[model samples]
Target: MPTATIAEDDDGIRLDRWFQRHTKDISFNIVSRWSKSGVVRLDGAKAGPGDRIAAGQTLTWPEELPVPVATRPTEKPREPLSEAQIEYMRAMVLHMDAHAIVINKPPGLATQGGTKQPTSVDAMLDALQFDAPSRPRLVHRLDKDTSGVLLLARNAKAAAFFSKEFAGREARKSYWALTVGVPKIAAGTIDAPIGKQPGTGGEKMQVDTEAGLKAKTRYRVIERAAGRAAWVEFLPLTGRTHQIRVHAAAIGHSLVGDGKYGGKESYLTGGISRKLHLHSRRLVIATPGGGTLDVKAELPPHMAESWQMLGFDLQLGDIEIVEPPPPPLKKRRLSSATSGNRRGERRSRGATDEPKRPPRKK
Candidate 1:
């Protein structure tokens, strides 16, 4: 058996990737087989194939004969659908069409499942009973905390076409974010190169000029309140994981309620009305039908409430300023002359009137 201690830079890497780095002789196929047989334990428990291996996790891999392919199941059968699962299936159907389905994903739900839990966007789709033999497929993904427009393809051909469009950078996505402070500039572009942070649970993205992928974002200040938050529109030119969040934070204006990227103040003070103030507001894509497809999602309740509290009119693009209170006045120090002047009258009254004679002896 080979043992490895997870490092800080390895946070968001897959279990297979971790094993590949540590055990030079082990093949990915063998590791996959071991994962299926429950030979690899992450943090003292069985880990799945897609589980992100974070730092501080203890990984143990057994070195043994390859498990028989016949013995190992190809894929686990879907579990019995629960009431909640059924409801999700029903909701998914509402978004279905001939070619694609668009979903209004809520916040706090992961697009894909990890080792510990199975309730994810993909799992739910797997459990769904479609009339045809084909299974639903994800065309794109959203962050766990960001709620809004998500697209899925119904068939393999459709999935392939959409994948091509995404890879070719033909898809256009827009987002609405409430930031902590008003940006000085009204409209500008953030041209930054984004690269994944090594070993930090794989959750962090950093700005790298030399080696990072090129990312471009066009931002316009929709509304700004002096000394408070601002509502902004974002258009990402390239899709890098957490690209928008990291770029915004790099400019010293983190999305409101984004705790991981220095958004604690906005979160705690209820600056923007939600746990995370960013939302996927709109998506425009070149449809398979030779036309454009535009979809928009309404603002979530939390974001709406916060906007109201800050006296913002989304439709009109107006905002009210609630400036922070001014700092207290500092006490002024008195000079030595001023202090002596105040006591000068008393000292003069006690002055002697007689003239003094010169001293003869020293």
Candidate 2:
């Protein structure tokens, strides 16, 4: 019998899920058959396929069963990366530590692969595994057209921790965008619920107040350009698919170059590139052990050009709003003597300090 101990990362997961993750050669039917035949045991006791697994628990199976060859369609083998491709991935690394890697993802680069997308950051992760025990895992994804501040976990433990933080909405993220028009309300929250649009095969999202997932975004206008475009900062309070884009379009101020959501109105008249202008500017999240991870990414080329064309100040720093704004500066209290003296002066100036009596004769 070959016995394996469950790791903490696999704690509380179903036995079938554990098998799927660790033993890829073995199918669920084989696991179920072995469990029924008493060939699969957990800590010397017969176990079923649906049983939950715990950390440090021993799982044993009979060695007589031969590993079956996969009959499912195999994926196309990935070609090796050239030296130039390796350097390209390395150059995108904005911040790298023991547990995390933050990259400045460029516009038009897909975070993960799709049927249409062949080259993606996920495919190139092997190039990023420098001195690490395994290739980095993606904790979250950036839209293929949107760029900036994509985080990667270096190992399984870090991946689990980061994934939980993002799922719980504990991670704070800020995005910079150039909207087609200035928002009527300069700074406010968008509390529109979002849902996938019908007939689009869930490829597009829309604001469906009646039946949609809760999606909220806080936005502030950093600057406006002659009533044409505005530089805005958006903080998503709740993560939803295409939340920012949908909310922005819902408010009638779609993002510049966001033709899918904004339609013809999304395009600007200037020489700006039609690529999406949304960028994940900053991210703040707690690390695995103790401290916090804060990172910021610079504006991509097309956005930088548009900013310059609009005469926007590049020196203006980011408005940090991860935490709540500090309380307003306290006002100095007036001393009692000073207050009295002011009242006396008002009286001398013919402003009566007491209420006037009316209609005494009546």
Candidate 3:
């Protein structure tokens, strides 16, 4: 018998699917027959086609049968990255450890590739492999024009753990932006629902309270440049596309240079940079083994210049502003007779506040 050890990248995959990836010539029918005959074994134990395999496990197959090989065309080889490309990718690294890599992704670079997008952070992931058994995985994303701390998982186990943290809202993020005008409320929450607009093929988002997903953002006015613009810090409670932008606009203080949702009013005068002034400032999330990964990324050049021109102090003290959750709906105390069943059930019929008319005159 011939045996092979599973790789980390192939962990938690079905036995049949693993064979299909490694040996394209092996059909499902053949694998099923081999499994039933006990020719396919995992660690000397009989394994089935549907059995999930893990890393470091041993898989053995009969040697008497012909070797399974791929008859399909080979995949195109990845191009070698240039020295400049490697430097560019590594320059953005803010922190790196056994399980995670935090990078300050620059503005104008898409997190992932799309139509007509030739380059992206995902495409350059190969450059950041750096002795890992597998390529790092993107746990979350930032917009193309937004710059900030982007975390990447170095392996599958870490990837799964980080993804769960994000999905469960265990991760906390803070953003800094230059708003067109001072918000009426200095510190408060913007509880607005947002959804994809009807037209534009989902390219934009709008506040659709009637049919939108719940989105909340807590903001504090960090500093004010007279009444023209204000430096704001945002903490989002729910992850939604363009949530901060739409919510900021909903409050009548759109982020500076955000024309998509803010319109022309977003552009600031007095030599302020006409670029979207949103930057992911801080991220706090739990790591796989233990402890937490908290990192802060520096502002990009354009935004830094804008801040300097506005006379906003980067070292100014600020506090974490969290909005208190809405109060619970008051419960209607049901009478003992109706307590056992749902409300309105087991209730006396025709019980009205008005005095019951005497059974006069049938």
For all candidates, what are the clash counts? 10, 0, 0
Best candidate (score: lDDT): 2
Over 1-362, each residue of candidate 2 has an lDDT whose tens digit, in order, gives 77788776566667876777766567788889999899898888989888877778998887765432232235456688989989999999999999899999999999999789989999999899999866799999999999999999987668878999999999999999999988756665677788999999999998887799988887777778978998888889898999889988887889999999999989998697788999999999999879999999999999999988998775443744333453355843344422423111111111222212223465
Which lDDT tens digits does candidate 3 get at residues 165-235? 99999999999998998875566567778899998789799888789998877667778888888888888
Residue 285's lDDT in candidate 1: 78
**Residue-pair clash count for candidate 2:** 0
Report the CA-based lDDT of candidate 1 relative to the real structure: 0.69
Candidate 3 whole-model C-alpha lDDT, 0 to 1 = 0.80
Q: Against the unseen true structure, what C-alpha lDDT does each candidate score? A: 0.69, 0.81, 0.80
Q: Give the root-mean-square deviation of each candidate in angstroms.
A: 22.8, 13.4, 13.4
Rank ordering of all candidates by lDDT, starting from the highest: 2, 3, 1
| Residue 252 lDDT, candidate 1, scale 0-100 | 70
Off by over 4 Å in 1: 1-73, 92-94, 127-130, 268-274, 316-362
Rank ordering of all candidates by TM-score, starting from the highest: 3, 2, 1
TM-score of every candidate:
0.64, 0.77, 0.78
